[model samples]
Target: MTATTTAANPDAPATAPRYEISVGGMTCAACAARVERRLNKLDGVSASVNYATERAQVSCGPDVDPRLLVEQVQRAGYQARRVDDVAGADGDDDSEQARRVTDLRRRLAVAAVLAVPLCDLSLALSLFPELRFPGWQWVCLVLAAPVVGWCALPFHRVALAGARHGRSSMDTLVSGGVLASSAWSLWVMVAGGTPAPGLGQGLSVVNGGGHALYLEVAAGVTTFVLAGRYFEARAKRSAGAAMRALLTLGAKDVEVVRADGTRRVPVTELLVGDVFLARPGEKIATDAVVVEGRSALDVSTLTGEPVPREVGVGDQAVGGAVNVGGWLRLRATRVGADTQLARMARLVRDAQQGKAAAQRLADRVAAVFVPAVLALAALTAAGWLLAGQPAGLALTATVAVLVVACPCALGLATPTAVLVGTGRGASLGVFIKGPAALEATRAVDTVVLDKTGTLTEGRMRLVDVRPASGQASAELLAMAGAVEAASEHPIAAAITAEAGAVPAVTEFEALPGLGARGLVDGRAVVVGREPLLAELGMAVPDELRAGRGELERAGATVVLVGWDGHARGLLAVADTVRTTSAAAVAALRGLGLHPMLVTGDNAGTAAAVAAEVGIDDVVAETLPADKVDVVRRLQRDGHRVAVVGDGVNDAAALAAADLGMAIGAGTDAAIEAADIVLAREDLLVVPDAVELARRTHRTIRGNLWWAFGYNVAALPLAMTGLLSPLVAGAAMSLSSVFVVSHSLRLRAFRPNR
Candidate 1:
């Protein structure tokens, strides 16, 4: 079949071969475009670049060599390495992030410096009649050009790049407005005569029949726009700083021992099988097994726990963990880019870059917004020109349409709100993956919660003890604790808690499918399930069986204790639901979301927990794969579902839900799958994040409406020759300021209870 199909389609062009290349040294929007341009110029290649993500997608013909493309990028002053896939690439380091921050800071400084003279000159020319210095005005315009050309180049470059890709963006709106206004004003000033043919008549009427240079208008707008972009860049940088902070936790330099001697090298240069020595109070530089020493190491940076853990020869130490007690020699098992810290940095980056569905909607809207506005402006200007207006009036109308219809305010609305909201969320110990996750929470109708480690305290605790026919409660607990003392299960933890100060056991044996048997006070003691006791030929009491039934109904697990060949007592243990769970569910209900509990436990246990949390709906004994089906069913039933969990088993459901939230300290896989990770492990934070996102979303919508309305209403008045360039510029600038001030309201918004 394949041979026949190939013979039939001989004239068809071959499928484009795809190449995944890791690009380096891309510092800004311009750098991204330069790389794209350089790559596109290569024979048999096509490329698409995303500057914000620092990634490129390339497709080429079979004749092209991927290695040659990478080498070409390197020769052009960037680092490029071919890989099987770009999606699996790791994030950059702190140094790379720091360099980007520095670059934005420099651009902001230049914009600030240029804005000073531009604003001063423009304000003086508008407010004071006699303070006009033509030379000073020209100086301000000259100063503004460089600022717009250099500091504001990203907007223009991005606009051009978008145009090349057959799309339009915010950059297109900004670049068109500033360039048109600036070029027109410069022409009038240099000629020192009547205004350019199309603008002179309008100027003649507005300034009372004399040529007027509106250079201040151009300079002022450019400076203000650059200032806005500078702050916007800073806001983005601040959000990225969290990832940088994580990366900075790794050691930058490490001490290495070679056959000759010891020396220092960058941590990235370290390799597996290399041995390194660590002294007391020093951190381990890589993941390694201790070769010749013992120490109490602090692994809190990776685990979030505070207590130091003891490690001896043959034990493994993770990289970035501190060695607190003694010196150690370690053989590197994993080093350099393979360390846990590096993996964590990569995870954070991946989480941030994963755009939510809501953001995609916003992007789709913005993609067509610029060209539509441009067409509107052109039509508005043509309508006036066809109405017998002079060339100058037509030109003024065109400029007004461009300036007033600029999407600067509309472009800023959502991103500014998201930036501020994410920053505040991070401070509150909430990690929202992206705008889509934030928005989904607002519309969530059902909340599926994990039972273990989320609704309840994950630790198992003994709730009750029942005495056998011939034994005291205290005596039974002592013997049971002694047997479980050497065990490592949750039941063992409970038993140890009850033991108090029991005598230590000499020998212990853990029965895999049953229980534990150990020598306590030189007697044979056993702790296990009923089946194990039956296998040991012990008789069960009727009262003990009834007690076990009651414990099971209350969501507790019952264990049997025996000494020699007789039944001692029954011990009951369960993980109790949190006290705050009821209130958190009620809060979600108050927000109009119906809360549901999904658990892997039996129906009785699930119902008990659901009742305690005031939730009426419960799905019990759900396997991990089945959880996604439950979520899908809820969605099909007209509910926008949000699934919350804290175990590796919950990961699939988390990704399947409309909004996936991982609660408590969960596994990395669960966190990666979630749209929101509640760092504080409180169910209440879920409602809090939802409330915050809704408030921010409302603010962004309000700002966008105001921005669009202001421009739509003002542009027509300016275009009909009723408003001059000076007035139009002032109105346009004030409208931008209004949008910004409106967005600042987000700083004061408090999430509702």
Candidate 2:
């Protein structure tokens, strides 16, 4: 879970490095906040600590050593280590969590095995004085000793560690509750004279003096709290399973195409610019551009798109894609951690390791929660004594308050949900950047979708070509294709592709957004939009003019083909709408977002695509700057807009909107600007992204409500002397388990078909 970034400067004082470190010994949100506070106290340091993942993201200058960062965390009463350093030293140390779980399981099993019989025997003897054997209290003491000493030792150790640092946590409460009950029970056993038959007579007294033995409560509370910790640890591990699975999807080894021959090498040893061979049914070693052969590659694991994408020479292939059709030679563009798969894993981890606004508030409340609970317990006990309540009743109320108000649920709520929700989104080809992106989805009421590359395929194709009266179709097409071949626009690609083979051109010049001009076979050929041709002193013939109007009206882009100051033909190009686009638009509307088409295309083309996709609002002929205006206007009109696009031109608008979702296949600029990334080509992920964020946000809110509400409702009952310590311990442990289990529900979240 280490994300490392460094900026070096020769003239500057020090370099800045940002990375993640695993934190140990955090039992609640207060501990996390404590670690965060310590790390941030350093000069030029910024930090965010997440208790759910038990990791801290820290950014500081080189002058602030990582060792110092770890020291500060240690001083805060926790263990800390740089995650990258651990990974480098141990090479995938996955056994830490397993070891922790195993230890917890062993402790819980011992506690349960002993505490059950101890509680049963004590209760049976107390309820029926006749059932008490001669040595019944001695047997209860022996059974309770191991549980209170060995099974609950972890809580005692953590509480002691916190005490040494002048801090406390949920473990403090648990340890206090257990030790108090056991101490009271031992005092009764030792101070009270040896009794033969009536030993269990007054053990069940509620309002009497504090002579009642609480061996059952001591053993029972220890067992229940240990059980909760064990289960909570396992569930938290499961919440991050999807990310772990994703991080392991890369190829382990690759066949390097060296000068001598092909040689298999570990993927870690593979370098950028090395040519590699991918055979049928083999995973592409890393992000590479195809150098030879053609194949159909399956990228479902990366992008969640089921269809196999056909790739040929010059096409880029991502790491982890399976080459399912034929052999291909690829040259690595990015290797190791620089590959797409690595970046995705890092992004998911960073998102999970971040604390949301709501979680920060919870952390603030929990920072003082343990101490406040300790104070409240004291107040309850004193008030009960002052109100003339019996010492036994006051003791019961004090223990209950300490046991019930743990704040574990408050710590687990947000991070667990975020972990599971983001993991679920990743599986469906939607990458939520962080907590901010999830929050952005809650109030989004308008969706501004770009026409080209978003709703439509964005690949232009030649649909019609009408030659002038004296020109042959072949001659006209060749001239246009030769000049267009020198250009790289989509329309040029379409004309060149349809022309098949054409004469070489010289003195080629491309007119940005208008078209291109070149000397094809030394005849001065020009191919461009009508406005460009008219500006070049070319006149459109009557027949070709009529053809251009007919094609333009039908939503096809018409570019005039002319040479030697005379128009020769009219070529029409159009982009096909993606088959899934209409359904995606409908899905967005179903989620209560108004869909609007914003494009740089002409009005007719924009309107045609909108009508086909069931969108009524259209903003056409807008430049990149104008697209931002469109989003801003909608926002000013009381709408929170989410912009979707996949081009460098759309970057500004994507950043200007309330939320931005970029297609994964788009330019780096667009992806950087967007809050979420849709990896699949299918537009349906747009709605899936929005719906998933909304669902995740709802889940977070629901978890927080339950956690806060449980404390609010449960605390009063305990303080008022209504709940016993055993029941309070059970409820406290169950609260953390419930929050974790509720978060695990997001693992089963399914995308719409």
Top candidate on TM-score is: 2
Worst 10-residue lDDT window for candidate 2 reads 5-14
lDDT of 1 by residue, 1-753 (tens): 000001111243446665546676543333444566678788777764444444455667688887777876666556677654222233443345567557767876876677666656555554555776547546766777776688768767766765665555545655676676667667666767643212233332243222344444455445555555545445445544444445556666778889999888887788898888888877788888899888998766554334677888867687877889998888888875556555444434433433334333334444455666688668766876687665445555565555555455554555555555554555454666665676676678888888877788666788999988878998889888887887755567787787787777768987643677888887777787777788877777888988877887978867888877877888987887877788889999999988888876556777888888898988876767778889999889888999888776688999999998886356666787888777554567778767877776676677667766876687667656566554555565566556556655655666577
Candidate 2: tens digits of C-alpha lDDT, residues 41-63: 78878888888888887777767
- Model 2's lDDT to the true fold? 0.83
Q: Spell out the clash pairs found in candidate 2.
A: none
Q: TM-scores of the models, in the given order? A: 0.62, 0.88
What lDDT does the true structure give each of the candidates? Answer: 0.65, 0.83
